[model samples]
Target chain A: MIILGVDPGLTRCGVGVVEAGASRRLSFIHVDVVRSDPHESQDLRLLKIYRGLCTKLDEFIPDAVSIERVFAQANRNTVLGTAQAAGVAMLAAAQRGIPVALHTPTEAKLAITGNGQAQKIQVERMVTRILNLNTMPTPADAADALALAICHALRPSGALQGGEREQHLTQAQRQWAEATRKANRGGNMLHRGM
Target chain B: MIILGVDPGLTRCGVGVVEAGASRRLSFIHVDVVRSDPHESQDLRLLKIYRGLCTKLDEFIPDAVSIERVFAQANRNTVLGTAQAAGVAMLAAAQRGIPVALHTPTEAKLAITGNGQAQKIQVERMVTRILNLNTMPTPADAADALALAICHALRPSGALQGGEREQHLTQAQRQWAEATRKANRGGNMLHRGM
Candidate 1:
């Protein structure tokens, strides 16, 4: 299975693609940060982001899309732009009949570094180690996107053979997966079951 | 010239179209509220709103599109959904090569009721009066949409002949128009100069 992850923002939308094997091994396929001019009008900036995501969607054709889910209490200044970017990302995925899942920032961090409150460097280090890459992805947003994809792939419910993966999963991983599953069941995650 | 106004929201997206003559006479063309099921996923809801706006854009081929400009300090619970819906609305307009403008609630209310803090009923009444409609438009969102279109049409820069319209413009109208013009110039209104 292939998954596309997005760390959505108007100024810099980070996207990464990862391929997952039946054995649960993951391989990085692509990564990039789509950017729009800050001086441009909001509509045009949104258009650029939407078109860029559409192009990536068409190119990768990932089975699922994972995006960072922000809450209402997020930063007052940048939350609006972040939500708008995530909106377009979800729309882009849904337009092509791809299911989209929103994972909270904490969820991605916990999945990567075994600590929900992990620092940026720790998360990046873990993502690099998990993906088995020699060099870390440049910019924090790109690394964050890869972490989202990995989180989605390793989630308990998202695993191909749930029973086998459950036995090998760590205590932190199990707890995170269970929490995510409950969130999805409670309709808080905003997953599109396409 | 025709203008399509949108009061964007996820559950109920209000849309109105109006024709503006060179003499500044406004005529109502069409009005409807595009709705999406609340039980649907966010992606599907956004997709529905985008497709609905695109249909209106293609049907009317409006010269310009006007949307309610919401601020960051708005209601926290609904602000995210509103911004997302507005994002898709702007995208729909931009995708069709139509210029888009964002007018604040104060601007629309002041243009129609001569008061920025006008009540909903008062704004609705004034919209009916301005459009010369026999029956008031149903739903507050629909009325707000028409008011936005009228606001955009009467703005100082949007008028066909600024000098001619200036003679009959009220002090409130002139002030509102001036504010909008300045906001556009300041890069605060997010007007797409298509």
Candidate 2:
């Protein structure tokens, strides 16, 4: 299955597309940042995001769209913009009838690196290695988007490993397991507006 | 000029349409609420908001949309949803090429009842009287939406009264005046992402 991962933002949003390859391996298809001009009207800024996401949705036609959940404790100033950007992403995917998944940043980190508190550099490094890319996904935002896609792909519904591994989980893995469970359940969770 | 006032939310969004008459009088055209199912998926819930706003935009075709500027101090649990709802409203207006205005709840109250700290009941009373309605607008959300429209009607861009009132503004009024000035100055202010 193909996945589109979005790191939603107002000034610069990250978008990454990945497709599952043979033996459950993942390959990167596209990655980039969608930037909205701050000089433009707020409405126009939102339109830029909405249109950009729609274009990507039409082009990729991903089986599922994954995004980082907007946490309440994020930078207070940017949280709203981030939420709005996520709204555009969700709207685009929903309009096209695509499934959407939201992963908390930590859940995404754990899925990719088996650690919830992994730093940006560590996550970026792992994303490059997992996708078998020669270089890192630039600007960090794009890499974060890729991480979200990876998180979704590793969910129980996306791969058998995730389902079987749930049975042998450690006590500390319980939280991560619950997180993936909510995501794999696919839209059963409440709308946290991300 | 016609104005569409939006009190944005995830569960229940209030929308009101009003037009300006001679001597700066305001008359109500319509008022209603758009509600989303909490049991629905996040994407579907957001789609409900997007579609509802699009329908209202098509039906009203207002010259401008007036929405309450989302405040950070709102209920933590729902702030993200409120912001997303606002994003949808902005997208619909911008896509239709209509100008969008964001007013603080205080700004709306100040416009209607001449006090920024006025209570909800006071604002509702003023809206009913100003719109020449025999009965109060059902649901405080609908009343608040009308109050937003009334606020836009009395703004500097919406009416001459707003321009002249700037001369006698209070200290608190000065800040709001500057805020609107920034919004009208076309994205001159820092992007707050709301």
Candidate 3:
């Protein structure tokens, strides 16, 4: 199963594509940041972001699109722009009739680094190690996008609305779930197999 | 000049089209509320609103699009959806290369009723009088939209970015400005003519 993850922002939107193989092994397909000029008018900026996402959607054609859920409680200045960016991402996915899922930042962190409150560097490191990339995904937004894709790919069948949910854990997924349990023994952070 | 005004919302988006003639005379072209099912997914709802706005932009072929500017300081529960709706409105207009202008509710109220804090009914009454309409625009949203259009039409040349700005105030605009000054003697709430 292939998944497209979006870390939405007005000035810089991060996108990552990932594919899941048997036993839940993951491979990276693509990653990039969609940037728009901050000096441009709001309408023009939104149009650029929307068009960029539409192009990505057409090129990747992923099975599911995952976006980081933004909250109003975030920074008052950036929340509006963030929400607008996410809206365009959802619109792009919906235009193509692709299923879109929203995952919180915490969920992405927990799935990646086995710590809901993991620092950005930690999450980045885990994403690098999990995907076996020689170089880290530069910029925190890019790493966050990959984490969202990984989180959605590893989610249990019941947690998802109507998408593919692997029944068995691949060796790599098992190791990650074990790592999560090892990191938080008292907490119930186990994946489905565990 | 023809102007399309949008009072954006997730469930019920209000739209109004107005034409500006010589002497700043305003004629109502059309007004309606575009609604989406709340139970539907966010993406689909946004798509419906986007498509609805696109249709209006195409049908009316307005020279300018005016939208009520939403603030993040507004209702927490509805602010996100409202921003998303506004985003779609801007997107639709930008896609067609239509100039878009944002008017705050306070600005609309001041322009329509000479009172920034004017109540809904007062603004509605003033809108009816300004347009010489036999009936009041039903639903506060619809009236608010018309007020936005009127505000854009009556705006001074200096205030607008690149759209046509009338050098002289129409008779109706003069009366409205006079009324505004009369309503608040101590306030400098004058339109360009005053």
Candidate 4:
């Protein structure tokens, strides 16, 4: 299956698309950073990122998308930015009907280096070794994205199975659904004018 | 100044835009929830959110945006979704040349109710009392958004100052600036052939 991987950020997102099959072979489809102008409004910048991401999604047409799960304790702004990036990546995958999977950084490291605490360099080395690349992945973000994808590839399918995690209902959606269900159940009563 | 507040989430985001003056009087400009369809791809849902936010930014023309910060936790998927929503909000503000601010949930509660440990309902009541809304804000998300705005208003000027608390680069602009500075310094050093 074609797997798309993403390392999300507000201004810069690293994306990598790889083709994988029975032989454990990987062919790089794409890798790049999506950015926005600093002087622009936050809304416009967000739009730019969205558009850029959509373009990437369209181009890759991957069977699955994998993203790194951020688990960091930092400043409020930093955390906010990271969240936004992750949201965009998730949204992109959801829009295209592609199955999406998430990998923790630690899991990715462990999968690659047999150590959850492996450093960036170690992970990079393992990625290069596993993928058999002549040169290391340019930009750490791209490497991280690849690692996330690799982690997903190694995960149990059931572990990545999808359905609504929480009940799939907005407050309004829930209210409407409940009302409709009630109406359906009470149809005989309504017909009898009771 | 006009301040937009956002309570980011994976499924639904509560957004509030309010104008606050030096006298602390507040005017509600708009309030709503940005939602995504679960049946759709996550990426597309995020794009919808990004576009919706952009439209709001255009309509309100806020001077700054305030968003809730996500904390590091074991819930990897939740954290990822929250981060993406936060990123969309930040990009929206930044693109508009509006500065963005972030506050922890406790900081916002403390600012609104003088009690960091205040419950959600308690914070909502305080927000209603503080803003003198005609009625309690419809959904808790909207109330939380207003609370974030209030927190930003209560903060001292430049209270949400931009700087890397741990390193030196938090936002893209800051990172670019740092890179430029280093480049210029390196150029000067190169002129001396060192």
Candidate 5:
């Protein structure tokens, strides 16, 4: 199964796509950064990010997407931007019907470096070792994203299977039923008033 | 200036547009809900949100966009969905070059009801009174979004003035300059190797 991992940020988003084979071996397929145009308005910057994300999705076409979940942080602005990036990643995956799984930073770090509070350099070193890369991944963000993908690959529940999609469809159906009921009730009321 | 408020969610997004006059009097221009088909993929849901937002923008042509900043809560899944909704809203505003501002729930509640912990009913009542509505806003989410827009308007910082585009441009220029410098340095290294 091919899994795409994303480290989301407003200015720069790091994406790493990995293909997992038998015996949990993960192979790197692609890695890159999606950047927002700094010269554009904040709205335009977001658009740039969205477009960049779409391009990445089209290029990688991973079976599943794994992204870092927003952690509780003191900087509200930073958190808001991070959340926006994560949202874009999630939406991109969801739009394609690719199941998305969220991994916390600690979970990824622990899975990669065997330590929850591992430093960036340590995580990078372990990521290189695990993925058997020729050189250290440029930009710490990319390395972090790769680590997230590897972490998901190591998890028992990480692989994209058919059962998960079925569950999602079932849940969506229930929600649709509820919304339809509400809409019918509103329509009935309007007709009665008329 | 006209400020558009958005309360984003997975199923329904509440939108309200209010025109802020010089005397601080507010006029409601539009209020409605943007919804998505439950059976759609996550990407389609985001697209639905984007299209809906664009329609709203085209219809109202507001000067600024104000939205609730997603707060980290107990349910990671719910927070993720809220963040995605927030992203769609921000992206929609960014695409239009409209300045966007984010307000916390407590901040919005305090601005509308004079208390941070005010109940939803109290907030709805205050919103109705403040906007002189014919009736209380349906679906408290819409009322909350309106309250957020009002809070942003009344803020001393003048939240509606656009900022992201200019900063992005400056940053992009700086990055370009840095890249040029790096290329020059790399040329020197190549000359030494030759």
Candidate 6:
């Protein structure tokens, strides 16, 4: 199954596409950033981000999209921009009929580093190791996007396939299970998108 | 010129289109709501809104689009949804080449009721009076949408043309000036967005 991870922001958005095999082995497919100038009008900036994601979706055609969900208590300007960018990412995915999931910051950090409050560099190192890359992704946002995709792919409930009927999966576990089922379906490529 | 005002929220997005004569006469052209169910996933809800507004813009083809800029200090859930909805609204306008203007909530209230902190009923009553409508627009969001269009139309700097340029026009004043000039050129219906 293919997963596209999105780290959304107005000034710079990071995106990564990765393929996970039936054996759960992962391979990096693509990584890039979409940037909008800070001095541009809000309309132009938003359109750039929206159009960039739409183009990426058309190019990569990932089975599922994983987006970062930000906390609202951050610096107001950053949070507002991030939220809007996230909306555009979700819009692009939904318009194309791709299944989408949101991973909170803590959920992502916890899944990747086994610690909710792990530092950025630590998370980046883990993403590099998991993807089996010799050099880390250039920008931090790009590596973060890779981490989100890995979190979606390898999280516990999804990983523990044969152990069904637990009836007590954590929220994260439930998300992983549902997301895995949805992506694993991976409908025919010839008849994709609305 | 025709102005389409947007009150951005995922659950209930309000839209109002008004015709403002060079004589400064205001007439209601259209008023409606775009709604999304809360129980649905965020992507689906946002896509519904984005599609609905795109349909509205295509139908109305207004000369300009006006949007409400929300403050970040509001409830986290509501604020996040509002910001994303606002981004979608802007994207619709930008995609169609329509000039877009952002109005603060306080600016809308003050423009309509002469008080930034005016009560909802007060603003609704004033919108009814100004538009010469037989009754107030239903739902406070609809009324607020009308007020945003009116704020974009009748604000101080845009309305105070040919008046001496003070040594220092406030930032809002400058924006009103630029937005008015761009909207006023008001190219033929064939070409439009900013």
* lDDT winner: 1
Q: Is candidate 3 or candidate 5 better by DockQ?
A: 3
What TM-score does candidate 1 get on C-alpha atoms? 0.90
True contacts kept of each: 0.59, 0.57, 0.56, 0.46, 0.41, 0.57
DockQ of candidate 5 is: 0.18
Query: How displaced is residue B85 in candidate 3, in Å?
Result: 0.4
Arranged by lDDT with the best first, the candidates are: 1, 2, 6, 3, 5, 4
- Quote the lDDT for B58 in model 3: 95
lDDT of 6 by residue, B70-145 (tens): 5566665477788889989999999999998887666677677776677889889999999999999988788888
Prediction 1 global C-alpha lDDT: 0.84
Candidate 5 error regions (>4 Å): A21-25, A36-45, A73-77, A110-119, A158-194, B1-3, B8-12, B19-27, B33-55, B58-61, B69-84, B103-123, B129-132, B149-194
Q: Is candidate 4 or candidate 5 better by DockQ?
A: 4
Interface RMSD of the predictions, in order shown?
6.2, 3.2, 10.2, 16.6, 16.1, 11.1
Per-residue CA lDDT of candidate 6, range A14-79, in tens? 998889898678999999999998777788889999999999999989999999875566665577
Best candidate according to TM-score: 1
Q: Summarize candidate 4's per-residue lDDT along B33-69 as a digit string, tens digits.
A: 8887755555676778777888888988888898876
Candidate 6 regions exceeding 4 Å error are: A158-194, B158-194
Candidates, DockQ: 0.44, 0.49, 0.30, 0.19, 0.18, 0.32
Q: What docking grade does candidate 4 earn?
A: incorrect
Report the lDDT tens digits of candidate 1 across residue range A36-60: 9988888999999999999999999
Model 4 CA deviation exceeding 4 Å by range: A8-14, A20-25, A29-64, A70-84, A92-99, A103-132, A138-141, A147-194, B36-48, B73-80, B114-122, B158-194
Rank ordering of all candidates by DockQ, starting from the highest: 2, 1, 6, 3, 4, 5
DockQ-wise, the better of 2 and 5 is 2
| CAPRI-style quality class for the chain A–B interface of candidate 3 | acceptable
